[model samples]
Target chain A: MNLGVDLTFLEFLASLPALVEWNDFTVGLVAFAVKFAILVGGLLQLPPLLVWIERRVPALMQRRRGPNRVGFFKWRLYGLMQSLADTIKLIFKEEVVPDGAHKVFYHLAPVFCVFPAFLVACAIPYGPDLLVFGHKIPLSVVRLDVGFLFILAISSLAVYGVSLAGWASNNKYSLMGSLRASAQMISYEIPLGMSLIPIVLIYGTLDLGKIVEAQTSLIHWGVFAAPFSFMIFLICMFAETNRAPFDLAEAEGELVAGFHTEYNSAKFAAFFLGEYVSMFVLSCLAATVFFGGWQVPFVPYETIVALAGSPNIAALAGIMMLLLKASFFMWVYIWVRWTLPRFRYDQLMSLGWKFMLPIGLANVVGTAVVLAVLRFK
Target chain B: MNPYIPVIIVLIFGVLLGSILSGLAAFLGPKKYLKEKMDPYECGVPKVTSGSEKMSVKFYLTAILFILFDIETVFLYLWARTFDQLGWLGVVEVAMFVLVLVVGYIYVLKRGALEWD
Candidate 1:
C-alpha cells in the first residue's frame, strides 16, 4: 500500500485494483492503449502481408509467377494487394457449420485460436524504448516481468482452439485430426520448454527485457551462448507451430486439411491467421533471445543513441533490426514449407521425445556447469 | 499504475477482435444449406463409421508422458533464473532433477509406449 516504495512483480500483481494515483493510472492506460494500437494492431495486419510473401516467395523459388494480377491501379505493388483481395473474398464467403457439429464450440474454437495469439504477440517487446519529454516508454503493449514464462504459458493455451475445432466439426477426420494436433502440440511442448531453460539459465533472468540487456554484447547473444539450445529451440519451434516437416497433424494429403477440415469462411481464416501470428510472435522471440531483441549487432544501444543524437531514432532502428531478423526467420518458415517433405507421424513424435528432449535436458545441465565454473574462475 | 492492467486490456481487445473476425462472415455472407452439403467430407462418399470413433491410444500415452515432463521442465525454470546466485549448488540440484527425468524417459522408451503402431 506504500506508494513511495518500490514493489516486486508479485507485489504489483497482488496489489492491483487497490492501486491509487488517478493521474498515473490514466497516463499508464493511455500509454497501453497507444502501444496496443501500434504493436498488436500491426500483428493483426501482419498475417495478410505474410500470406502475400508465402505465395510470392514460393512462386519465386519454384520459378513461377505468383498472383501478380491484383494491384491498386497500375502499380502492380509486387502482388501485395493479392492478400487484400483474398481477405475480402474470405470475409464475404459463406460460412458453414455443418450438421451434427456442436454449434457453440464450433463458433468458439477460432476465438480460442485468436485470443492467445494476440495476447502472446502483444507481450513481445518490439524495440528498446521511446523517450519523449524525458519520459520513458517501453515499446511492447504489455510488459510482464516474467515475459518469457508468460509467453510459454499462454501459447500452450492455443492448442485448445485446434483441438476444439477438430472435435466440434463432428466428423471422423475432424476427431482424429484434432486428437493428432493436440497430442503433437503437447508432445512438442516438452522439448520447447526444455530448449528454453538454457536461455533463462545463461541469462539468469526471466524478464525478456533483461535477457536482451544481457545479450547487448554480440558475443553474449543467445544463439552463441547456447547454440545447442537454439538448435533444439529451432526444431521445437517448427513442431510447436505446426510448420512443415513437423506438420503431421494437418498433413493435407493425409488428414484432409487436418483439424480445420470443417471450418469455413472467416472461421477457417481465423485458424490460418492464428497460425501465422504465432509464427511471427515466435520468430520475434527467437530474434530477441538469440539475435538480441532490439540491440544492433556490434553497435550497442548507447552507441546507436549517441550516433543518432536521439534515443527515439535509435529505438526505431532497433525495432527495424528486430523486425528484419524476425522476417528472415519468417522467410525461412515459408522456404522450409516449400522445400522440405513432411515428417512421418512416428518420426515427428520420436524426434521430440527420443532426441530433442534429452538433448535439451543435457544442454541445461551443461550450461549450468559452465556458468558455475566461469563464476568460480 | 499497476502493470497488470494491460493484461486485462489485452484480453478484452483480443476477445473482441476474435469474435468480430469469427462472426463477420455470418452476417456478411449468404447461407443456403442442403442435406448433402451439411454432411461431413468423407471423400464425397457416405459415412462408413460414426464420427468421433475411438482413436489410437498412442496419443493418450504421449499426453500422459508430456504432463510429467512438462511439470519437471517448469520446475527447472525457477532454478534457471536464479542460477547465478545459486551457482554450483543450483547446478548440482538441477542435474539430479534432470537425471531422474532422463531415467524415466528411458523407461518410457523401453516400454514401447510411444510407438504409434
Candidate 2:
C-alpha cells in the first residue's frame, strides 16, 4: 500500500498471491470480521459523543452550562456519561403503540432507517491491514466498484423509510412531517448527486477508494481543484442529513416530534441513533472524499511513511488521522447547529433548486473545461 | 461474474420462512370473537359497511404518475453508469430524456396534479 493513498481490501487482496503468505478465504473473512467489529464498536461511541457535544456546545454558545449537573461532581466538566444515562432512561421508558397506526409499517420503519447507515459503512475503508494468525489481512469489509453510487442509493432509501413512517402513523402531524422530509430529501438529493459529479469527473472513477487516492496526489484534492463543487456538496450534505438550517421535518415549533411523534422506547431510540450515525457517516464521507481522507497535507508521503517505519504503521496512522478529521467535522456540525438558526421552508427549497443546483451544474462544466485544457496543454 | 443464483435463493428462502412463521402464528394465536375490535371506528362512530365509496381518481392517478417517473429515473441511472462507453452521444440522450420529463412535470404543475385541494 502506498503512503497517503487510500487502498480498499480488495485491492490489497488482488496483490496478495505475489506475496509469500496466505491460505484461502478463511483468513480474509476473519480479518474482515475483525475490521467490522472494530468499526461497529468505534461507531457506537459516536452517538454518545455527539449527544454530549450537542447538549454541551449549544449551552456554551448560549452562555450557559448544560449537562454539568448530570455527571459526578469530579467529572462535572466532562459529563460524557450523561448520554449513557439518557440511553438507559429511554430504554426503560414504556413503549407505546398509537391506535390506528399501521402496525407493520410503523414497526419496520426504524429497521429500514438504521440498516442503510450500516450498509453504507461497509464501503468505507478505515485501516490498512489486519494481522490475523501471523498473516496480514486487509481491513475493509467490502469494496464495490460502484461504492459512491451505492451510498447515494442508500441515502435515497432513507427518505422512503421516513416517508413510510410518517404516512403509516395515521396522525396528521406525522404525515405532514414525513411529507416535508420526503420533499426536502428529494430536493437536496439533486444537488448532492450533482455536486459529487465534478469530483468523479476529476478522479475519473466512481469508486470511493480511488477518489481518496486521487486526492493524495496533492494537487488533485477535490476541494482545492473545485471549490464550488465542495461548497455545494457541503451545503447539500447539511440539508441531506436534515441538520439545523434545513431541518424542517423535525422543526419542533411546527411538527411535534416529527415522523417519530407516536413512536416510543427502543423504536424511537433507533430513529435517534440512526440520525446521529448517519450524520457521523456523512461527515466522515466529506472528510474522506474531499479533504484527502487520512493524508497529512503538505508533508511528503515518503517522510511520514518512512518515519512510521512500515506500511502497516503508516496505514494505522492514516486511520487515526481519518478518525480525527471526521470527529472535527462532527464538532463543526454541533457548532453550526447551535450557532445557526433554522431556515424557512421556502428558503430551504430555493437554496436547493434555485441556487445549489445551478452552481453544481456550473462546477461540472468548469471541471470539464479545466481537465480538457490541462490535457491540451 | 454471476452472483445471481445465491441472491435469488436467499430471497426465496427468506420470503418462505417469513410467510410460514407469520401464517402459523396467525392460525395458532387465540381467536377472540369481539364486536368492537372487528368493527371499523372513525372518530369512535360505528361505521355502516359496504357502499360505493366516493373517492377522487385524481389522487390515485397522481400516485401512478409519480411511480412511472420514479421508474424512469432508475433507467436514467443505468444510462449514467454506461455513459463513458456511450460517449457524448449518451450525454445528449440523457439530456433529452430529462428534458422530456421536465416538460411533463411542467404540464402536471399547470394542471395542478401536485396540488392538494
Candidate 3:
C-alpha cells in the first residue's frame, strides 16, 4: 500500500517528452472533435429511446402492451425501432410558438437545458487511451481540476431553464411545476454535496480519474466503508434526477405536463432529452465515486492484463464495465419512475431537509472519527 | 499530454463558436414582429404583472448558508493534507476552527434564521 504521490503531472510530461509533447495537442484536438460529434448524435437519439423506455417499462409493470405497432418489422422486435421512427416523424412537424410567448427566451431555454448534460458527458471516461495516427489519447474529452463542482454547478443551472419555461408559458400548471422543480432541486442539492464530502475526505482528491484509481481494492470502494453516505447519495441522486417518489414537479394529475406544458415540437423534446441524459450523468457520477469505477474487482490489474489481455485491452474492458454499471442504473431509473407514485411537496421537503441532511452529516463525522481512531491503533 | 494547451484551445473555441452560432441563428431565423405575437405574455396572461410577487426567502437563505458552510470545508481539506506536518497542534487548530464555525451556526439557528415562515 505505497500511497505517496509518485510523479507530478509536470514531472511525467518532462520524463516522456515524445508522449506528452506539443504534437500530442493535435491528438487531443482530434479526440475532442470526435467526442463532440458522438455527444451531439447521442443527444439527438436519447429522448426517443427514453420515451420508449418509459412506455415499455410502465406497461410491463401494469401488464399492458407498449409501442408494439410502430416499426416496419412489427411483433418480432416489439417495435424496438419505434423511438427512431418517432424521432424522424417529429423533425418535420411544425414548431408551435404561442401568441404571447417571449420568443427569444422560448428559443434559448432548450439550448440551455441540453448543453449541461453534453458538457458533463465529456468528463466521463469511455474507453482506454485510444490511438490515432500513432499517438495515444485519453478517452475522456477534458480533465478539469474542479470536475465534480463543475458538474454540480452546471446541473443546477438547468433549473433556470425550467423556471423560465414556466414563467414564459403563461399557464398556472406550468408555473406551479417549474416552481416545484426549483425548490426540490435546491433542497436536495445540499444533502447530495454533503454526502460526497466523505468520499472526497477518503480519497483526498476531487479528480474523478484519481478517485477511480484509489478504489483499486474491493474494500476501498466508498460504499462499503461509508455505507450511510452511500445511501444518502443514492437517495439524493434519485431526487436530483427527478425520478419517481420525488417527481412531484411533473406529477401529471396536478400539473398537466408540468414545466414543458406550453412547449411543442423540438422545444418539448429538448426537455425530455435533458432529463434522461442527466439521469445517465448522475448514475455515472455515483458509479465512479462510490463503486470501484473502472478498476476490476477482486483481480489485480497487472496479473489480469498479463495473463489474458494486453494493457490497452484491459483498460478498455474496465471502461466498458463502468459503462455497463451506469447503464444498469439508468434502467433502474426507468424502473423506479414507473414503480412509485410522486411524493407530496411537504413530504419531499421533510425527507430531504429532516432525514437526509442530518444523516449525511452524521455519516461524515462517523467516517472521520473511525479513520482517526484507526490511524492511532 | 500537454494539458494546458488543450484546455486553452477548448476555452477559446467554445466562446468563439457559441457566439458565432447564436448570432447566425438570430440572423437566419424569420423575424415577424406583430403586436399580438411580439408582446410579452403567456397563455393569454399579460406579462406586466406575472410571477409571484414574493417568493420564499427561506429557500434563498438556505442555499446561501449551504454554500458558505460548504466552502469552509475547503480549509479542513487543506489541514487534512498537511496533518502530519502540523502534528497535534495542527489538529487542535482545526478543531478550534470547526468549533467556532459550529458556534456561529448555532447562533444563526437560535435566531431562527433557518426557520421557514
Highest DockQ model number: 1
lDDT of each: 0.86, 0.67, 0.69
DockQ of 1: 0.73
Residues A262-348 of candidate 2 have per-residue lDDT tens digits of 676566767776788888888878888888887767764556778976767777777887788888888877777877899987677
Residue pairs with backbone atoms closer than 3 Å in model 1 (clashes): A288-A293
Off by over 4 Å in 1: A1-23
The candidate that wins on TM-score is: 1
**Which CAPRI quality tier does the interface of model 2 achieve?**
incorrect
Per-residue CA lDDT of model 2 for B12-112, tens digit only, reads 43334323322332343344556564432233556453212333454355346645554654565555455456656655566576667668766766776
Between which residue pairs do clashes occur in model 3? Answer: none
lDDT, model 3: 0.69
Looking at model 3 chain B, which ten-residue stretch has the lowest summed lDDT?
A: B17-26
Residue B27 local lDDT, model 1: 96
Rank order (by TM-score, best first)? 1, 3, 2
Better of 1 and 3 by lDDT: 1
Give me the runs in candidate 2 sitting further than 4 Å from their true place. A1-22, A72-74, A129-136, B1-117
Chain B of candidate 3 vs. true chain B, TM = 0.68
TM-score, every prediction:
0.94, 0.77, 0.81
lDDT of 2: 0.67
